[model samples]
Target: MIQTGEKELKGIIPGSWHILVKFWPQIRQRKLLIGSSLFALLLETALGLLEPWPLKFIFDGVLLSRTDIYPDILGFARGLSPMWLLSLLAVSIVAIAALRSITAYLSTYGMALAAIQVLSEVRSNLYSHIQRLSLSFHQRFKSGDLIARVTYDIERLRLVTIKTALPFLANVVTIVGMVVVMFWLNWELALISIGIFPLFAITTTNIVGKIRKETNKHRTSEGAIADTTSETIGAIRVVQALSLHDMLEENFLIQNTKSLQEGVRSLKLATFLEGLVKVLMALVLALVVWRSSLLVLQKTLTPGDVLIFVNYLKTAFDPMRQISKQIGQIAKAIASGERAIDILDYEPHVRDLPGATKAHPFYGSVSFEKVSFSYDPSRQILHEVNFDVEPGQQIALVGPSGSGKSTLASLLLRLYDPTVGGILIDGRDIRSYKLDSLRQQISVVMQDSVLFAVSIRENITYGRLGATDAEVEHAARLANAHDFIMDLPQGYDTIVGERGGTLSGGQRQRIAIARAAIRHSPIVILDEPTTGLDGASEHAVNEALNRLTRGSTTFLISHNLRAVEGCDRILYIEKGEILERGTHPELMAQAGRYAHLYRLQNDTNEIEGVKHVLEA
Candidate 1:
C-alpha cells in the first residue's frame, strides 16, 4: 500500500511558484483565452499610461500657457486657442477612460472565465482521481477532509486566480508601463521614486512566509471543522440519542475558533505588509515632491512634468501596494493548490497492471491459493490459507469481528491486492484482469448499504446503468423491494434521504439487494446483509438475498451462524487464519470453536426470547 506518513505530510511545502508550475499544463490548455486576456491587459496598460498625458498637456500647454514645451505629438494643438485645447484634453480624458474600462472588462472577464474553466477541469480530474485511489488511501483519510480538498480547496484556488491573481497581473503590467514612462520623462526622479521598492520586496518576503504558514494552518483547521460537521451530521441520530449535541457543539467551536485565529493571523500579516508598503510609498512621495519642487524652482522641469512624475510614482507603486494586500489570499491559494496537487501526484496502490486486459465472462469459480494480505507490514489482515469454490457454489466465512472475514471478501472484490499470495478466477491470476472488468463480474452488498440521495428507481438502476424500467422492477421484485417501493409516496420515483436514511433498514437492504441483483453478475459477496434488522425484516431480507444469490457463486460473511447453515462450506477464521473448514453440520460434528460459538449464540438468543415472552 502507498503509505502517507507524518514526515511526508510536513515535508517540502510547495511555494507559489511551484503551484504555478504544477498547474501550468491546465493553464496552458486555455492558451487562446489567456492570450486574448493578455492582449487586453497590455492595451489597458497602454491606455492607463495615456491617462495622465491629457492632464500634463492641460497643465503645461493650456493652463500655464507654456505651449512651447509641447512635444511633437501635440505640436498641432499649440496652434489652437486655450479654450479649444482644454476642450480637446477633456474629451481625450473621457475617451481614454472609456476605452480603458472596455479593455479592463474584457481582460478581467476573459481571464475569470478561463480560470473557472481550467479549475473546473482540475476539480473534475481531482474528483475522478480520488475515486480511483485505493480503498486503503481513503480509509487513511477523513472523508470530510477529502471533500474539503475537492470542493473548498479548489474553490479557494479559483477565487484567488480570478479575484486576486488576475487583477494583480494587470496591476503589475500597469506598473511596468508606468515605470517605463516615468523613466523616459525623468530618469533621475524615476530612480529615486523606485528606491523604496527594495523595502517593499523585503517586507513582503518576510511577511509572506508567515502568512502562508498561518494560511495553511487555517486550511487544515477548516478541513477539521468540515470533518467534525460531516461526522456529526452523518450520525445525527446516534448523536441525538446519546445527547451529544452540546459536546459536539463544543468540539465544533474549538475547531472553529482555531480556524478563526489562524485566518486572523494570516490577514494580520498581510495587513502589516500592506501598511509597510503604504509607509514606504509615503516616504518616497515626500522625497519626490521635495526634490522635484527644487527642480521646478531651477526651471529644469515644468510643473506639468512634476505632476506627471508624481502621478507615475503613485500609479507604479499602486500594484505593489495591492499585491501586499492580497499576499495572504495568494498564500492561501498556494496552500490549497498544494493540497490538490498532493492528491494528483499520488499513485494508487491497487491500480491495474500495464498488461492487464478486460476479463472474459466469469464462470464464478474462485480460489485463494495461500493468499496472504496486510494493510501494512506490521498488521497482517489475512493469513495464507487456501480455499477453492466450484462454479455456483456458496461459501460461508464465519469469524469474530476484525478476524479477516471482511478482508477476504474485500480481496475477492479486488479492493486490495494480497501482499503474499495470489487470488485466481477461473484458474487465472485475478491481477491479470482489468480492475473494472474483474469487479464488474462480482457484486457486493455491504453491511451498511450506501445509497445516494436520489429516487428509488434511480438507486435500483445504479446497479446497472441504462437498465430498463422493467428490469429495475423485476430486480426489485426479486429482492422483495418492489411492493414497499410501490407503496411509497412517489412509488419508485420517491427520493431517498442521504444514504437511504428515509427507508427502514430492511427496505434499504432489499434495495441494495435489488441493485446487486440487477447487475446479474455471476459472483456475489454478502457481508452481514441482514445485520441489525428486526426478525421480520431479517426474514424478508434473507428471502431477498436467497433470490439475489441464486445461480451465482456466493461468499457470505456473517456473524449469525444459523444464517450460513445451508452453505456448501464454512470457513471459521480467527486472528487472520482459518482454523476450520467444513459444512455447518460437519463443523458441529467437529465440536470445535465454530460449534462452541454457535451454541453460545443460540443460548443467548433463547434467553432473550424467554425474557421477551415474560415481558409480553
Candidate 2:
C-alpha cells in the first residue's frame, strides 16, 4: 500500500528528483545487472514490434494474393506458395512470442533484484542513523512512525525501478520504433494517430495531480493508525487494567476511517484518469482507422499496409496508456522517497566529533561540574548540578519523582550533553571520548528492565558480546537468577516474550541484573532495580546487588528508604541540588530533611508492626 505524507512532500518534486539523482551512484554500482536488464527490455520491445509484421504478411500476401506488398519486408514469403507463406508467418509469430516472454521475464526479474539490493542498503543506513540520533530526537517522533519511514516508505521507493523506470523505458523504445514504421507505411494515418497525444498528456497531468494529493493524505492517515496501534499495544497491560478497550477501539476507528475515505478518494481519481485514457485511446484508434480506410480505397495503400498502420497506431499509443495508469503508483513512490530523505537528511545532534579519541577504560571516577540542562529554555530540568564520586564508591541518590535523579543518570550515560558546563570521567570531559567507547565503560539497569524477545541467554549476553557459556552462567548465579533459569524448560535457552513479559517482574529484574553483571564495567547505575519486587524477591535481588556492587563505582537511585541504608554514602537530592550528603547514620544525626523523612518512614513501619502483632 502507498505510504507517505503531504508535509513530507512539501518540496517533493525537487526533493524526490534529488533522491533519484542521488541514487544514481548506487544504481551505477550495479552496472552489469542493470545493463543486462536494459538489454532484455530492448529485446522485448523489438520482439513486440515484430509481432504485427507476421500478421501483415498473412493478411496481404497469403489471403489477398498481394505478394508485392512486403516482397523485401518478408523476403521468405515472396516466392513461397500461399499455404507455405502462411505457415512461415505463423511460425515467426510463435517464435517472437516465446522470445518476448523470456526477455520480459529477464528484464522484470533483473530490475527487481537490483531494486531490492539498493533499497536494502538504504534501509540499513536509515536504521543505523535513527539509532545514532540523540534521545531528544526519538522523543520528538513515535517509534511506529519511525518504523514506517524505514520499512514501508523504503519499499515504495523500490517500486520506482520496477513500476516506473522499467515500464517507461521499454514502452518508450517500443513507441518510437512503432511510430517510425507507421510513418514509413502511411504518414497521413500516423499524424492522425499522434495528434491525440497532447490532449492525453493534459488530461493525465490534471487527474494524476489530484490523485497524488489524496494519496498523500491517505498515507499519513495510515501512519497515524500505525502509531496509535503501536502505542496502545506497547501499553496493553495498562489498557487492560483501565478497561480502555472501547476507548482505544474508538480512537483507532477514527484514524482508520480517515484512511479509508482518503484511499477511496485516491482510487476514484485514479479510475477516472484510466477511464479518460481509455476514451482517448478509442478516439485515436477510430481516427486512425477512418483515415487508413480512405487511403486503402484510393489505391494509394495496399490492404496489408493499412493493417500495419492500424497495428502501429495501437502499439505507438500503448506506452501513453501504461504511463497514465502507472502515474498514481509513481506519485506514491515519490512521496515515500521524500519522507525517506527527510530522515537521511537529518544531522544527529549527539554524534562523535571528528578526531574524537577512543576512551581508555574508566577508573570509575565521575564528576558533574556546574552542569545545566533543559528540554526547553523556559523550564530547566537540571540546573547547575554538581557532584563528585571517588573510584569504586557506592553513592545513593534519593529524591522525589521529578527531582532530577534519573536525569543525572542520563547525563552520565551521555544520552544527552549538558547545555552548559560539562561532565568529566577520570578528569577527562566525556564529550572528548568516542560516544560508543564512553558508553562501554558504564552499565545501566533502569526501573523497567527492557529485554528482547530472544532466548534468556541471548538477552543476558547482550551486555557483553562474546561471553562464554560458563561466564554467562556465572553472571546469572551472581544475580540470583541461575536457580530459576535452570528450572525453566529450556534452562538458559528459553525464549522470553516481548519486553520479557513471559517472566515475572522479579524474574525480569534478576535477568537485567545478570545482563549488567556480565558487562563487568567499572561503573554501574541501578535506578530502582528492586522497586516492584515482593518482600522475598526484593531480599533476593538485594543480595544479588550486594555481590554485583563489590569493587564497582555504583549509583543507586531508589525510593525505598531501607534500600539506601547499606550504601557507603547517601545523597538527599531535592530540586536539582544535593540537600544532604553523608552516611545513613551521619544524616540521621544531623536531623535535616533526610533525617525527618527517614524517621517518618520508621514511625509508619513501627505502627504497621504493632498493628500486625495485635491482630495475631
Candidate 3:
C-alpha cells in the first residue's frame, strides 16, 4: 500500500528532509493550531527584545541620575525632572513583564495543540504500515520490540516533538533578536559581548554529534525493555506451564538494568552541556561589565550602558541552554521516524504476477500437479506431490507426524507458492484468483483451532461475518456444541476466555468447526480437528464434521484411520510423498503401509475398548 521505492527498508530513516516533507499534507489539515504556534513563537521573541531595554531606562533615570549628583547620594536624586523619567520607566517595566507572560502562554498553548495533532497522525500511519508488512518481517522481528516501537518509542517522539520543538524555535528567534538589540544599544559593546560566539559554536557542534549518538542508543534500549515486558506478559501462560516464570523475570531484569544505564548516560551528557553554557554566560557578562565600567569612568559611557550590556549577556544564555537541551530530544525523534519507515518500505513476497485475473467461486474439483515446496530449500518438504479429487468427493490424507499432510493444506491455501509447480481449482491456476477470494471459497479447521477472546456467538459469526444469529446457533447445533454452550449461565453470550481457555478441548474444537460450517464454503479441510478429544467427545465432533462437510469437497488429514474410513479415497503419505492410496477395504487387502497403520490403530482400539469394559 505504501508503494515504497528502492530507498526504503525495514526501518524507514529519511536520508533527507524531503521524505519527511510528505507528512505536511496530513499536518496541514490541522493548520490553525500549527500556524498559531509559529506566530506565537515569533511574537514571543519580539516581546522579549523589549524586556532589557526598560532596565536601561531604569538605570539611566531613577537609579543612576545620569545628569549630575548633589553632595550626598539622596540629595543627588532630590529634585530635577527625575519624576517624569521615573514614572515612564516604571510603567514600561510593568508593561514589558505583562507582555512577556502573554507571549509565553500563546506560544506554549498553540504549540501543544499542534504537536498532539501531528504526532497522532504519525502513530496511526506507523501502525498501518506495520500491519501491511508481509509475514516475513513479523517472523524475524520480536513481538515485544514492535509493540514497544509502536507504544513506547512513538510516545518518546511525542514528548520531543511537542514538548521541546516550540521552545527551541522560540529560542532561536530570541537569539537573533538579542543580537539586533545589542547592535542598537552600542555596536562596539555588542561586538565585545558576542566575541565568545565562535567558542560556543564549536562546543555546541561537538556536543550535538555526541548527544545524537547517545540518545539513539538510549531510546533503543528503552524500547527493548518495553518489548521484553510485553512478550513476557503475552506468553505468561506458557511460562507458567513450563515453570519458566523465574527465568523470564531474570531476562526482563537484565534489559531493565541496561535501560537504566543508558538513561543515566544520556542525563549525564545533558547536565554537562548545560553547565558549560552557564559558565560561558558568566564569563561574557563579566567582560562586558568590566569594559563598560572603564568607559563610564572616562566620561565616555554612561552606567546605564554598562547595565544594559550585562542584562543582554544574561538574556543571550537562555537561548543557548534551550538549544542544548532540545538537541537530545531531536535525536530520539529521528530514530523513531526511521524505525517506522523501514516497515513501511518492505514488499510482500507473494503478489499477483502481471496480467493476473481475480478468482471466482471455486467448483468442487481440485488438483495438485507436480507441486514441490521447501520452506527451507535445503530439505524439500513436498516433492512431486500429485493428487485429484472429484466434485463432492471426500479425500483422506493419512500420515506420520513429519509427513507433508499439513504442507498440502498450506499449499491449497496459498500461504506460500510452490517452488516448482502449481495447484488448480476447477481447471484454473488457484493463484489467478486474488488471495482473499481464493481463501474465502475454502474453510479449514486445524488440529488446534484458534478461538478469539470473544463471545461464542461472535466467534461463530467469524465464519460468515454477516450471518444471522439464527444461522450461528444452527451451525453451533450442527457442530454438537449447542448443549454445552446452553449449559453455561450466559449461553452464547458467555465470553470464551483467551484461546477458549475456559472450555474443554472438545468444546473449543467444536466451536471452531461451527465457525467453518457457518461459512458454508464449497471446500472443507479438517486437519486432525479432534486429535485430543475423549472417545465420546471425538464421536460427537466427528458427527459434527460429517454434518459440516456434507456434499462439500473435503480433505481430511489424520493419523487415526477410523476417522477416514468413510472417505471416497485415502492417500497414505510418508516423508513427502504418497506412499500408497486406496479405499479402506482396498488398502486393508493390500497389507502395505496404509494397511499396517490401519491394523495397528484397530488393535490399539480393541485393547483400549476391552480395558474399559473390564474396568466397568
Candidate 2 backbone collisions, by pair = none
lDDT of each: 0.88, 0.85, 0.79
User: Model 2's lDDT to the true fold?
Assistant: 0.85
- Residue lDDT tens for model 2, 386-446: 7889999999999788888998899899888888989999999999999989888888888
What total of clashing residue pairs does each candidate reach? 0, 0, 7
Name the regions of candidate 2 deviating beyond 4 angstroms: 1-16, 71-84, 201-280, 315-318, 604-616
Give the winner by TM-score: 1 or 3.
1
Lowest summed lDDT window (length 10), candidate 3:
1-10
Any idea what lDDT model 1 has? 0.88
Q: Model 3 over residues 1-616: C-alpha lDDT tens digits?
A: 1112111222233432533575676677878877876787787788777676656656765677664422264353446576776776678788877887887888787777776777678778878777756454677889888887788876876687677766777777777888887787678788987788768766765665566567778789888888888887898898789999788789878888887887787788778877888888788877888888888899877777777678767877767755654654565566775666565566666666676777776678999999998876699888898989998999999889988998898788877788888899999988787877788889999889999999999999998899898998999999999999999979999998899898999999999999999988899999989898888989899899999999999999998888899899999989899988889889989999998888898899999999999999
Per-residue lDDT of candidate 1, residues 152-211 (tens digit)? 999999999889877877777777777788788788898997788877755665676667
Off by over 4 Å in 1: 1-17, 198-283
* lDDT score for residue 130 of model 2: 92
